[model samples]
Target: MYDTILVATDGSDSANRAVEQALDLASMFDAELYGISVVDTRRYGDSMLSGSSGVIDDLSDRAEEVLAGLEAQADVGVTTTVRRGRPHEEIERYADTVDADLIVLGNRGLGASGEIGSTAERVVRYIDRPVLTA
Candidate 1:
């Protein structure tokens, strides 16, 4: 029932599982698959020191690597994107832009485990589309 499926990844174990799930679903439905990795801008802050710190650059590089890994693991062609902003907001916006029929993401990403990651929780709460958390 899905046409375009958007999967958000953070290179975490759970995110990797989500990628596998999204890939399977996309293949099953013969749908387009899109992968996204967001560099959380909030983590770097807006201060001048933050800009000079190179943490954002590092994060961006990590995001790119995560997307690359996702693409490599997929048997089918995967459209990948890297964005900088709040993870949930960027994911939601990208999903809307792609007109995704399903949004798949990890329930807990690179953050501390025990509960759902804030970004995934927020995406589920704010995004209107169907979200599958792996």
Candidate 2:
């Protein structure tokens, strides 16, 4: 029985499916649902590259918007958070901070590669808790 469930989303179709699965799992287990959207800032670094002005800000804004939309769709009471960093690392860190019993994430994301996205692969590699890809 999970006490807390975390879902990492990027507003992609796969991620949305994961969200629904997480919500359903949370509802079934009567667990607290937590949502996170991470703005991948590893490429941006500390200083803005000349051509990438407002790119970080834009990503951050999109992350918040994604979280907001997820919150609206959630049937159970959900706590949503936004973080800036590599998606996999930030997600694991956040899950650890919240003591999540399970992590629900997408098999693929916006990138839509034939294989799983690096974020999901890395998260599975590093996280100690159960991860369900929907």
Candidate achieving the largest lDDT: 1
Candidate 1, which ten residues in sequence have the lowest lDDT sum?
44-53
Model 1 error, position 3 (Å): 0.7
The candidate scoring highest on TM-score is: 1
- Could you estimate the TM-score for every candidate? 0.94, 0.92
Q: What is the lDDT of residue 94 in candidate 1?
A: 96
**Candidate 1: regions farther than 4 A off:** none
Worst 10-residue lDDT window, candidate 2: 44-53
lDDT of 2 at 1: 91
| lDDT comparing candidate 1 with the true structure | 0.91
- Alpha-carbon error at 127 in model 2, in Å? 0.9
Clashing pairs in 2: none
Model 2: lDDT of residue 71: 86
lDDT of 1 at 6: 98
**C-alpha RMSD by candidate, in order:** 1.3, 1.9
